[model samples]
Target chain A: MTVPRYTRLIQSLPASVPFVGPEEQERTRGAPFAARLGANENVFGPSPKAIAAMQAETLEIWKYGDPTSFDLRNALAAHMRVQPQNILVGEGIDGLLGYLVRLLISQGDAVVTSDGAYPTFNYHVTGFGGIIHKVPYNGDHEDPAALFAKAKEVEAKLVYLANPDNPMGTWHAGTVIAQALNELPEDCLLLLDEAYVEFAPEGTAAQVDVEDPRIIRMRTFSKAYGMAGARIGYAVGAEGLIRNFDKIRNHFGMNRMAQTGALAALNDQDWLAQTQAKVSQARDRISRIAGDNGLTILPSATNFVAVDCGADGDFARKVLAALVARGIFVRMPFVAPQDRCIRISCGRPEDLDLLAEALPLALAEARK
Target chain B: MTVPRYTRLIQSLPASVPFVGPEEQERTRGAPFAARLGANENVFGPSPKAIAAMQAETLEIWKYGDPTSFDLRNALAAHMRVQPQNILVGEGIDGLLGYLVRLLISQGDAVVTSDGAYPTFNYHVTGFGGIIHKVPYNGDHEDPAALFAKAKEVEAKLVYLANPDNPMGTWHAGTVIAQALNELPEDCLLLLDEAYVEFAPEGTAAQVDVEDPRIIRMRTFSKAYGMAGARIGYAVGAEGLIRNFDKIRNHFGMNRMAQTGALAALNDQDWLAQTQAKVSQARDRISRIAGDNGLTILPSATNFVAVDCGADGDFARKVLAALVARGIFVRMPFVAPQDRCIRISCGRPEDLDLLAEALPLALAEARK
Candidate 1:
């Protein structure tokens, strides 16, 4: 009955899951949600060509995918306007962030991010025993200048900034991020997470040199390409930094159909444009829905809208719970001030109609 | 031009790949392989049911996979006859091995493995700054007794053993392993990688209790199930240790189609048995091909055969290069004595026909 001896660090760490998935919630409730938009997944789906390509490649699933992710890297390089060596494709930004954290953070290393920015990034940092310094959001945006100042104060090795940030859906223009890089500390690397860049306005992607080692931009097909199920994401950075990822990466850890599907998705610009249009319509519809309910919506450049719940975190939580109770899946920011709102992702008209029907009733229930 | 401040351990590691896929070799040669017999990939392909399931689920690739992997875990639990709490599904054995290494190994921690065993295991151990103690294989078989003795001598926290070993295609009966457990040191965890167990003879899977805390059994869909590109594997260990994976796992990292396809694959045992029969026939055909070329093949309980080149490591390398030149993708073990054997994975009858045609010419090239 003797137990295996785990390492001290692992022994000290608490068992944690950054997010409990919708499927688990569904299982617990013994029923699936009517509208599945809580996780910010693009419900519209991937390009038809990607679906066709993946279906075609299903028979090739016996063979291991390219260890180097050769084709995907070349395609992403061409798309990002960078050399192939500047891009590293991985199992979504979540997996890449874990690898990045492992590469930089040893025990007691300092890292920085907005207090309520992506929790998965924070999980990776803390898992590696890194000390985190969090700066509160400036208004609804993740304040890049504040994050850099905190990184400097802590002598952090890494700082994470999500452009067109999650939960809030607000973003700074490319020029703002390009300027904010000047305040980032000497040894600190800015993790510029652009997971929602495709849904954001033009110029939202920072205009940094691909040779800038100070920042690595992570983008995902999970958002605009509508391939969250594919689990593919990539980071673009200075050639040398991207090369360093090979030091410990699981070389053959990629899925073959994911590579095929993502490549097809990248080549279908018309389909992407159509998806963008639909997302734009859904965003507008969601805003109107918020306004009709006498609630105000935050300005958003991403697919999701944050509707102010007219009170504090507690009230917003109650509304969120009520919506969940009514079979409309939605989420809210976990931090104060920002937590006064419920975040709703751009869904199909039918899905949003469910939200429309549920909100007022949910609000009245919350008012109780 | 500042470089990212990577951790000292990461800085110390050389960028390494355990195995390069056959696709990379084809790209380098500007030709596709006539016989893809390397990398232990099944050429007969996955179950038709699995392929159909994967194709059907392609359009649903818009949502992230069930982070909990609820259905797959429950299915794996039912198939393995273990409690669901004892299972931990992950991104293939490579990815799961990485997580396990991270959980147990710190810088300079002692670990043990056979010298010529799976390189990926060594890669993960070294990546985590663990000190690996290698014991030589005894008479072409991985000496479990020697591995356990070394684990005791070095006070290793982890000992890796691949039953139905790769490269040599050798295996011990399950009862041999159950007896070997008595020699394994207390406080040491046995990482029993059974990736090829389904291809091996009956009783090849060890008879250890699912509640045993001293061992963790890792199996994959990559081998007999023929879904290597899906990047799916699972570990069965004691409930508490299996629960520990939550502390650092990327909860939502799984691909949706993979989960669906693997569940379908698991449910089709009839297809699995048919694939096993095909593998057995291919192994016999490979042996006959080796014998026709004045070579001998190792007795295998796996989906591959190791043909003795009757020469040194350099000779085997020459033969491997010659085969590659002839568009035959085959590999040889890297360590001494074992290096005299070029490993050939079971392939389709047509693929084996190409191997039969090329072996004599490759041997002549090696002699030259």
Candidate 2:
């Protein structure tokens, strides 16, 4: 049989999923996860209004979504205080990352990110044949200065930084990021992922001029908005850079329900504020639970807490495995030092009670 | 300010939407289209069970979908009588086409499709920097023999054939396609897009081996399944080729509602049969209306009929514009010969009633 011809870059790339979803884990385990905390998905669920909007759209599912995503983008633009031309919505931040990488990274182009940062971004860079330069997290934070210096040194086309970073759940203040942008290489574009910004403190989102061509900031309904499965996200940037996304994106890729759901979610800021408060309370409970178990919880600005297991990566892995075995799903960082901690998303009181009950047993099992 | 450094290929490409959606036309005209038959979307909508399933999923929209798409793929496999390994589900057939083109087509690589076939497929080919070799439609049909000869002539890596083709709504028999496969170049892969096949007559789908390495077939929930807005589709191919999609696909790209919705729709074959019958009746009604208006309707085996305006491409263009102006949405093919006809999607009786009322007036306006 003649083997099908794949592009040389594609042939060289590994067929891998960046993260195995919690549902997949459940299937493998032959049971549903009790807590469902591993993937950093919000457990508070979407706003009731958003759910209603999506349900309303379910009956009209025959028509393709507006390719321009006009209504959603317009709402987002108004909410962000930017022109609609400054925004480009897509399947998710994951999808937008793929498009951005494809637009900027030709084969052998250099890109930079923290070593243990969002692997999906790394996956996209590598999929597009971009050479990835890894910068280690500075004390669990994505060191924007270090990333910029490296980008300048390597002449990298793109540098990725997730504010209120994942796995670690650490963040830099917006003022710090604003200062760091001055050090960014002249030719480099900053891909600022703010997936967790809604859960972060007020000043965590950088005050960038919408016309600044050097950076694009992406936000998603998947995080604090509680609509990850809906897969709606948008990037705000200079019109020149944002318009380039239209050159390559799947124009009709946005789900109709996603557009409607996100618009409703955006309109319901009361639900958002309420969810944030609930997340804050849950974060405290999780921190206290970790402390009660003699574990140190990393200060988190996002929905998840990373607990220091007081040992190395292996011990943390054992704790994570034990938690999964106990039906409490939690994940951990992949690289060293950071890998000594296991990440847990903030959940409802009952869900976190399951975690609280499981943690001590998991720790004991890991120690044994 | 420094210009954003897009890839050389991206720099050369235009920021174009492959299809201007009906929503966009409504935005421009400041009124919705009365008929809504332009994009081949099923006005009958999805199975009520599918809508209910999606509605049930709306409340649980906080979780990301299973990255593996295990359940949906397995269900599709059972429905198609193939192993789960044979299927690869995606955001839509459009999204899958992008992935397929990206896998096989590197810069300047050769690919073949009929000139008036799916524009989105052609857009993907060009976006990947693939050199396109177009074969004109054979008497409004996608001629597999001509396409195969052209593929052989150009040593094309990919040859696209949409069985029960789009825009023209023309099709060839399964036996004819199977025989044409004999002439297919050994090295070229045939991309059989069966988006409209669910509405095609029996004996239309080619009975190829699921393990066949020379061809891959794609189907969608968008057409007869009435889930276009849900944005779900899948491709069945050799395990070897199917596995490569994992190398570059957005792992979490599939919307959670789409997964549940498609599975529900697939299981409700009774609803599908009813839809097919509705579409068949709609096609007949459209043909009769065309006859009354002194237009000629092509013999259709799909959800839409191509009505010859009986003059030329320009006349068809004028007719389409007149229809749009009369609040009746319809489309025409973009290439010659085929462009002389306007494509009207199967719609509800009330929608076709509006079309019936508008046709004579539109024809009169076009003639003037």
> What TM-score does each of the candidates earn?
0.99, 0.99
Enumerate clash totals for all models, in the order shown.
Answer: 0, 0
Q: Candidate 1 docking: what grade?
A: medium
**Model 2 residue pairs with clashes:** none
Error of 2 at A104 (Å): 0.1
**Which segments of model 2 are wrong by more than 4 Å?**
none
Residue pairs with colliding backbones in model 1 are none
What does the interface RMSD come to for each candidate? 1.5, 1.3
RMSD of each: 1.0, 0.9
lDDT of 1 by residue, A43-100 (tens): 8889999999999999899999998889989989999999999999999999999999
Off by over 4 Å in 1: none
TM-score of chain B of each: 0.98, 0.99
Q: How far does residue B328 in candidate 2 sit from its true spot (Å)? A: 0.5
Worst 10 residues of 2 chain B by lDDT: B1-10
State residue B276's C-alpha deviation in candidate 2, in Å: 0.8
